[model samples]
Target: MTEQTTGRLKVRLVDGLLILIMAVLAGCGLIYEYLLSHYAGRVLGAVEHAIFATIGIMIVAMGFGAFAARKIKDAFSGFAWLELYICFIGASSILFIAAAIGFTFHLPQLISDTFNLPADVLPRGGWVEQLHQIARYLPYVSAACLGFFIGIEIPLIARVREALYQKHLTHNAGTVYGADYIGAGIGAALWIGWMMSLDINQAAVITASTNLLIGFLILLLFWQKIRWRLLLTACQLLMLAFVIVLSAYGQNWMNSFTDMLYRDQVVLQQQTQYQQIVLTERNLQLNNNPTQTSVLQLYLNGRLQFSSMDERIYHEMLIHPVMASAPKHDSVLLIGGGDGLALREIFKWPVHSVDMVELDPMMISLFKQPRQFLPIRLAKQVIELNANSLSDERLNLMYADAFNQVDQLVAQGRIYDVIVVDLPDPNHPDLNKLYTNHFYTRLQQLLNADGVLVVQSTSPYHAQDAFIAIGKTIADANFSAVEQYHQNVPSFGQWGWSVAVKQGLPVSERLKHSLAAQTMPVIKTQWLTWPIVLASFNFPQGFYKNYVNIKVNRLGSQQLFNYHDQAWRKQQGMVNLNSNQQISP
Candidate 1:
């Protein structure tokens, strides 16, 4: 080949490799951004807010990084260093945040011990509170840093490409920017399609590994022109080794860090496609006895579901009232009670069949499978607590969304004598649909002519507006009768339930009459009895009598979510105010 032809071919090869590097960088950058946001959401409450704020801060920081990239003297060295920095930050971001929060939480106790200050006398607005405030902002700060580093990547790659092809390359910006965009698209696809299935820490390690590989590739391709080639290669190899080590033991570190965040010992923690599931256990020793009283608790997305100590009260109140009042308890449909506690209650009656629809199979498996970490066998504990209801021959479990499953059941001409809506509260916007009038209407259609449906409404005392809105929405769904009741469960104070029947018979009257006739449940209950059920229907004078401003929760309007949010905020405000008052001089 001629010397001129050889030069041209070398330039073309360099150009292609640079473009490919940009694509890889783009994918890895976006993944890092998402990883920080997701981790923040998991650690902090208010997932929606955490995700939005982290992503927003990162995007803006990226712009700053891009603007700052103009100061780079050597594009090759800068890009390689940038990739190394990203790999380090992305791999360790979650660990850093967890450690920061853990430190913040313990700082107060450490200070108290250092100065020998009384725990009760810590200043109301003290260093401890200040540290907490700072901890709250750490996630955003970390996200901005990651975003800024990621932002410089594309600009640096563009400059590197320009230097490589010199006068031969035209439209450098187009080539660089196009590759970045396409690589980002692929990154998103990989994240949603595959990466999300892995544990959060595992996903971070994977992305970091990709970032390190990109750095190595760039160093190899331009080794002849690059300065400090051997040093850079060694650094890249060290980082790769570190990332591999993290992948093997990162989850254990995460669990230990997370355990500090909760009041109880975290026994099992898993990251599912939908949400984070954490199980905590507290063993209370009576008089320092070797035999301890263990309380197993389940939390989803950091919200407490049930504590073994008081779960029976909640489950009994949730299941027995409707089961007793239904005209015929031959067939039942349960939605969202994957723990099998309610199923245990339902199996008390000689029902011919029970169909259950729950969204997360991981939840079911966690409760059903054996685990070495657990103090007791999970399946055996569940069987003992739930009376072996899940293993019943007639129980049919459907791992699917309750909203779509209801439609499917309706289409197949399947109807149930009793329908139990044991779903989580409509604390999130996505859950609003399940509480909407339209969803309740569909549920009503699946009920047999004399069928009864019951929903576990949020606490009437704590979330009065939400409780009233749920009852109003169900009444508006064209059920013949709807009645709201509540029971005091220690785990969840003042929990509520709403029952509806298709025959248009007033549920209160039916329940009152049934109680007067001394009706008893065929199956024994720990906390629920005819008198207790009757008393649950009675609220304090004017408790709900004047709640006329509550809005009906419709599919489009989703008023329940707003009501729920407002009520919880008010409750939290009261709690904070009381706490401050208690600590004041």
Candidate 2:
């Protein structure tokens, strides 16, 4: 005995449960990232502002939670009840949100709008309004509860340590931090592997159980008397169990309703770590064989990414200009694009070898196996992805790394005769870095003097300013000049692309349209004419010109958290569905 009451053996239990509770608290951050993106995509008319709007609100709420922790007068036994409350909040979160959106917003919109019902009678315009309400405020609530608990645990564990033996706050903090990091790692793995598959209801149940069990363990270790507060906690959980069952059942109706609202000829839907991958088809071109039908499209995170049919416009734009300008085509590197469209273009050249490096093994697996992709071409040579391998000698030409991922390759001093960057929009800051001044300068360093780099900028017509900003961003990065172009693709609406070189002109500007379009295995975009090329750079004076002031950084920066990404779909005038819940974050 270190001259304390029998109260001191409580140390081990409090420390262990502190680890567990903090694990649950840290869960909020990762889960927030995934759910914020998912919910924003689900809602119609959501802007780039919403991602920032939600994140800011949640962090503020966490501060509020830390402030509120000062008011809790009772310690130890009373604090144990807070763990139970945390469990309840964590478990019910996904269910409450998904069910609310699925039923309240999505279902009624499809059914009522299709049948033509009165808005006064039902929650018309569906759950987008409701989900907006949730996304705007609910995150704050989540942070408050999670943060309050976390703040208290720091002091509670400190009290336990002081009660046992004298250790400085710094030493205790390190131990707590070590345990928290390890627990968060475990939780992240479980979240990706298991929670991703479970429906919103089941996800809640699992989350709730993890929290409640942790709470029970905490109480058992610290509090000897099982009081009224513990009983209340049990009863609250039983009621939540009932809510979970109802919400899960409601979501069944929601899924069908959401499908009809979008009217997707949905080909595939998978939640990968990268983003939500959805493949869809529209029978626009009528054909004799019903089996061999219309165009197939790919959507990532609710935005139209690419279509298999006219994707040639985007891919050809990315490939041909660079290939024609490059000194040699001995070796090539492709990243992120596991779709095999970019690979099809590379094979068109007389290249010695090509390395298709993709981060997600799933994308490569899909291309390699016909059963997985169903008619999609396989990759040339799918290699395991790692940033360290960028220094490898084999690659003479590279495509696939998004602007954010390009930094590592740039730092490695990997040079290429030609570089093709075909990533999703700079709708968020993370994607925007690749288009920034710093990234372009790094890109210029990676390209040989004669090397030409072609970047797939967004639609010149829809997002001309952002497109111009990209051009200027490269100009700021020390590239002498930037070339721009636009092409019509049904799946992507009106899209734009640009090519930048260190010391040479793009082949299109220098040479005439002398090379004839040859028939290829995939679609050939020989239709790329001088008229289209000239018109691409011709922007109306009315276009927004904020590109002059924009600043781009390498990391801990913007996250492209501004440029509204779902632009094309909004341009196409697409609509979305219903939702579940009373609680907002």
Candidate 3:
């Protein structure tokens, strides 16, 4: 071969290697973004805000990093060091955030234990509060640091390419960025398709491992131009060993960190596509011996769903009122009760068939069938708690989003005698949609003329305005009768529900008629009685009478989410109330 041909081939090989490095690093950068945002959302309790805010902070930091990259005189060494920093930070970021938040969560208790303080005597709204606020924001801080490193990549890569070719290429920026964009697209696809469902620590380690590998490749290909070649290789090997250990034991360490956040012992925790599901167990000690009737609690996305000690109260109250009030119990539609506790209550009546729509199949499967993944004792307790109601042949489970499922049901002209909505609180915009007037209207189409619909509204005492807005939103859907009621569940204080009748008598009157008729057998329950069911309809005077201009939660306007967020923030002392904003009449 001619000398010119050999020289050209060498330059081309160097150029191709640089582009490939950029593409893989771009993928790693995107995964780091998702990993931080998802972990923040899970721990912070405001999923939507945490995810979006973290991403926004990271994007701005990336811009800053790009501008600052010009300060580095040696592009080859700079790019190599940038990958090392990103890898280390990305791998350990989740663990650091979890520890910070977990410490803040346990700080009050630690202070109480140290000083022999009573339950109500601990400190509030001082350094303790400041620490908590700071801890809650650690994820964003980590995002900024990681994003800064990621931003340095493109500029340094372009500089390194020019240095390798001995001249500035006019299209260098465009070519490098094109590879970046394509790699980012692939990263997003992997996150949505597979990585989201994996253990969070594993995902972080995998992304970090890719960065470490790419950094080693850079060290091999450009040894002469790069400084501290031996040290750089050693650092890469050390990082690779650290990542290997993280892949093996990181999840167990993560669980220990998370376990500090809960009062009870966390037995099983899993991350599904939809949300994080955690099961905790509290033992009742009788003379230092654990009782057989221990309490099991289910939490979704850091919010408690139900506790075994008092779940009977919640499930019975949710199911029996509507089931008893409806004229027929042959067919029913249940939305969002994936736990199967409500189904256990419904089966007490002579219901012929039930169609349940739950968005998360993992939730249903956890309660329905035994799996080898769960500890043997937890599996038994979970299945027996709901009395294995999910395995009954009468259940027709449809794994679908309730919003789209209701629309399909309306289109199919399906009718039900009773419809129960046992969903989580409206802490997110997607959940707010399910509580909107448009959604209720679609559900209204699926009910028979005399059928009843009951919704699990949030707490009347803590979130009075949100509770009121939900009832008003349902009434705006044009139901004949709408009434709000409340009961105290120990795990969740002062919970409430709203019942609506399509036509004829209201829920109270229909329930009274059902009680008066003696032909059917009395439906027995642990927590609900005839008088208690009737009394739940009677709230404190002026509770439902809203004097302020509280608007209905339409589809687009997230008024309900705003109300719920503000109410809870005020309750936690995170926000100062405005004199103009009165939730209760």
Candidate 4:
């Protein structure tokens, strides 16, 4: 081959490798952003806000990173270093955040042990609270770091490509940016289709490995021109080895760190496509006896779903009021109670058929097929708690979004005597739709003529505006009558529910008459009785009188989400204020 032809071929090879690296790095960068946001939402307790804020901050940081890339004189070495930093930070970000939060959670105990002070006497508004505030920012900090490195990548790669060509490429920006955007699209698909199925830490390690490989490829392709070739290669190899080791033991490290975040031991933890599922167990001994009482608690995205000790109170209250008030209980529709506790209550009646729609199949499986690794007693506790309700022959379980499923049911001409909405609170914006008038109106269509519907509203005391808005929204759905009730379950204080019946039928009169007619419940309940059912509808005077002018939740406005967020913030503020007051001299 001629010398000129050989030079041209070498340039082509360098350009091809650089472009390919750009695409792969783009995919890795986007996944790192998603991982940070997902972890933030899981640890911080507000999924919607955490995700939005993390993405927003990362985008801004990306802009800063692109601007900073202009100062790099050597694109090849800069891009290589950027990959190493991104790999290190992205892979270890979650573990670092988990460790920080875990340390903060145990800070008070650490202080108690270090100084030999009584736990109760530790200063409530001291280092522990400050550490918590700092921990909350860790996710954002990690995101910015990842974004800055990712921001530097494309520009650096473009410069290197231009240098290799020895001429200014006509569509340099378009080529670089097009590859990045397309690669990000592929990354999102991989995340949803495959990566999400793995444990979060494993996914992070995989992305980190991709990043390390890209750095090594860049070093190898430009070895003749690059400085410190051996040192850079060694560093990349060390990082790759470390990431591989982390992937093998990441779950155990995560579990140990996560265990520190909770008061109870984390017996089981899984990252499903939708959310993180964690099961915690605590053993309590009565009067120092050898026999211990085990409490199994289920948490979704770090929000407690139910505790074994007092779930009966929550489930019974959720199911019975609507069932007893309905004209018939032969057919029932349950939404979002995947744990089967609600179904257990429904099975008590002579219901011939039951339909349940839960969004997460993993949640259902966890309850259906108890894991052997779980403490046998704790695993059995869940089965006993749900009473193996899913195993019943009459249940028609559907794993799908309840909102969409309810709409389809309407199209199918399906109707139910009692519809129990046992979903979690409208804490996230996605969940806000389920609590909106739009969803409830569709639900109203699916109810039988004399049917009754009950919704598990949030806490009446803590989230009063949210609770009241839920009732108002249900009434706006054209239900003839609506009533709100609450019960104090030890696990959750002052929890509430809203019940609605067909238009023109008084829910109170039906409930009263139903209780008076039936001297005893058809099925026995541990906490619910006829008298308690009657009393639930009777709140103290002026309990809701102050909540006038509360807007009904609508799909477009999402008033419930705002009210819910504000109420929880206020509740948290009051708790902190109370703690400060109690600890003050």
| TM-scores for every candidate against the unseen true structure | 0.91, 0.69, 0.93, 0.95
The runs of at least 3 residues in candidate 2 whose Cα sits more than 4 Å from the true structure, single-residue gaps closed, are: 1-56, 62-81, 104-207, 219-224, 229-262, 265-267, 281-289, 321-336, 373-415, 513-523, 526-537, 540-585
Using lDDT as the measure, name the better of candidate 1 and candidate 2. 1
Model 4 agreement with the true structure over 1-585: per-residue lDDT tens digits: 999999999888878777777778888888888888888877665667888899988889999999999998888888877888988998898988888887776777777798999866864466668777688679999998888878888788889988888789999999999888888988999998999888888999999989888888888877876777788888888898889888888778988988887778788888888887888888787887755767888888777889888899989998887787777888899998888899999999889999999999988888877855466766676788899998899999999999899989999999899999998888888889999999999999999889999999988877888889999999999898899888888877788899999754666677677666764357789988767877877777787886678999999797999998887667656563112111000
TM-score of 1: 0.91
Query: How do the candidates rank by TM-score, highest first?
Result: 4, 3, 1, 2
lDDT of candidate 3 over 476-574, digit per residue (tens): 998999988888887787889999998988988877776787533488888788789789888888876773677899998999999998886777563
Which stretches of candidate 1 lie above 4 Å from their native place? Answer: 1-3, 111-125, 168-171, 227-231, 285-293, 371-379, 541-548, 556-558, 570-585
Predicted structure with the largest TM-score when compared to the true one: 4
Summing lDDT over every window of 10 consecutive residues in candidate 2, give the lowest-scoring window: 576-585
Query: Model 1: per-residue lDDT, tens digit, 416-447?
Result: 99999998888767788999999999999999
Which of the two, 2 or 3, has more lDDT? Answer: 3
* Tens-digit lDDT track of model 2 for 370-399: 355554321111121111223234433333
Worst 10 residues of 3 by lDDT: 576-585
Residue 391, model 3, lDDT: 92
Off by over 4 Å in 3: 111-125, 285-291, 370-373, 516-521, 545-548, 574-585
Instruction: Please count the clashing residue pairs in each candidate, in the order shown.
Output: 1, 32, 0, 1
lDDT of each: 0.80, 0.55, 0.86, 0.83
